[model samples]
Target chain A: MTGRTIVITSGKGGVGKTTTTANIGTGLAMRGHQVVVIDTDIGLRNLDVVMGLENRIVYDLVDIIEGKCKMHQGMIRDKNKLELFLIPAAQTRDKNCINPEQMKELCAKLEREFDYVLIDCPAGIEQGFKNAIAAAQEAILVTTPEVSAIRDADRVIGLLESEGLHRPRLIINRIRPGMVKRGDMMDKDDITELLAIDILGMVPADDRLIIATNQGVPVIYDKRAPSGLAFSRIAARIDGEDIPLMDLGPKNGIMDKVKEIMGINRGAYSNA
Target chain B: MRDLIRWVVTRKENTKNAARNRLQMALMRDRMDLSPDIINALKIDLLAVMSQYLVVGDEFQEFGIRRLDESVFLVSNIRVKELPRANAN
Candidate 1:
């Protein structure tokens, strides 16, 4: 089948590009589609560790491109599912080792076998970033609800559109509902306005995501985590489902409860 | 108690609002590939050059980024009442 290659990218680092890639890849696989997630961040490869397949990688993306190994030989299957696979990036090789043409060709080969190919792009808009975007037909930009990240995401969107990767959907990650409710942080609405892109999903700040990442088991496996559920909805959207976006109302703590009991309702929870 | 009452009444968050202001300025500056310093210098130079030809009003002489339709403009609107008539009565 000719698969859709969607690249997950963010212009800033630590904004959850890799996490989004891992979760969305896993979520799509959970939907019973054959999916492969590729890490294009060659030298600073962390997707392997994040996916918990670092020990299993004898060959990597560079190896496959350099003809040192077969395509499937370098692919590591996920322990959780048979439908998912990951092609890890080589740690020793730099960004210069792989070019856009090779990446495009590699993606073309993967397109024949998988239903979805999600590439984890590097942070900066350099060669690694270019290679990741080379063969992808669609894009998913990940950004946090901060000025720094949104500014960079806007620049990345312009660059992507210039390359004909039009209308890339956005995923605003690590959104603190409490801060947003207090009007102390940027919310989903503000971020979408800043970036001028269709929002895919809003993943709230969840501590369980940290444990899940460290344990090499994606939060999607937990099922109850807010961020996990948010990611699953994103995957479903990508799979052409019409799921409504979830309302990210902040969790009312003890103070809020007291205020509510006293009839001094905070505006954030007034609608509730 | 004044601060607490003000907070309760106005619901104003100073730091975040201030950040939004800074972000707006920075984003506009980045898009035009010119820093704030450059823009400020340009404004000063423009005012100096224009003062030689016309009298600029303090109230209408403005320099900042403004959004129009879908485009962001680095605009400078100067109100000139007319060159202080070189040979007026």
Candidate 2:
């Protein structure tokens, strides 16, 4: 069967698009499906580093598009044994290097070979964003619970609707259940109501994600990490598995009370 | 006299509620681009002319024009106090 193309995007920056692309690709590959992640950031490529394949990138998306190399030559295999690959974007070139048509053609070719192709889209609703969405059959919009992020996500949803991309699934990233309970930040219901979209999953704000990214490791390798498990659940959903979302809230515990007393602000509440 | 006072209070409250509702609907419609600026401008001009005829008091409620679908509404409450004969002249 042909692969499904899924573009992971958020109109606002720093909402974990690249991280999600990497982890979901890893998660899907772990399930025995061949997966490839394409970083569409072009001039600002970071997915390679996030996936720990930066040094292995001999050729990039631009090189493949420009006919300097075959498509397979650009795909970097993961450090683990899973059948995951990375097509890093060219850092030297800008977004203008590849247009929507070219991206669509490339994804179409990749889909014939792989079971899943995840595109890590750039920030903003400009040409780069358009290029990423043109090739995908499914879209996963990532956003935090903050007002600004939610507002941008709403705008992005409107744009997607205009482009005929209907019913795109939502991934509310960096949620803090404690903050939602305290009424200090917008909750899942608040975001869902405002955006009026079906939610695929919610990922809590986990610090280990930073360490994992820095170490050139996809967080999905660690089953114990909250963020990693969240991505795995998202992957399962993508693969037609019915997995429940993770309970990110503070359960009954003395440590939870200590965290509240220490004033460890939760997710969106930290800024509010 | 008590009936007259109650009637006046009820009228005032009803007017205020109507004005608030109109403003909210108009604003929402305007945001959705269902109401054009031509109608909004016309509503503003009408409001300005009406203000000159009414003895609108300090407690007068002002509501911003809001758009609701295809309709434009003037959402505000003006206290139309009766002017004395000398003041009217």
Cα lDDT tens digits for candidate 1, B1-89: 99999887776754556556666666666667777788778877887888887878654367777876546777778888777776864
Query: How displaced is residue A73 in candidate 1, in Å?
Result: 0.8
Q: How much does each candidate deviate at the interface, measured as C-alpha RMSD after superposition?
A: 1.8, 11.2
TM-score of chain A of each: 0.93, 0.92
Give stretches of model 2 more than 4 Å off: A254-272, B1-89
List residue ranges in candidate 1 displaced over 4 A: A251-272, B1-11, B34-89
The candidate scoring highest on DockQ is 1
- Per-residue C-alpha lDDT of model 2 across residues A1-272, encoded as one tens digit per residue: 69999989889999999999999999899999999999999999999989888889899999999999999899899999459999999999888878999998999999999999999999999989999999988889999977667767877887788777888899999887666555555666667766779888888887777888889898777755677877878889989988765455776567657765885424222210
Q: Per-chain TM-score of chain B, candidate 2?
A: 0.30
Write down the C-alpha DockQ for each prediction: 0.32, 0.04
Query: What's the CA error at residue A26 for candidate 2, in Å?
Result: 0.3
Writing each residue's lDDT as its tens digit, candidate 1 over A195-269 gives: 678999898887778989989888888755778878888999999998877668744678867764775533223
What is the DockQ of the complex in model 2? 0.04
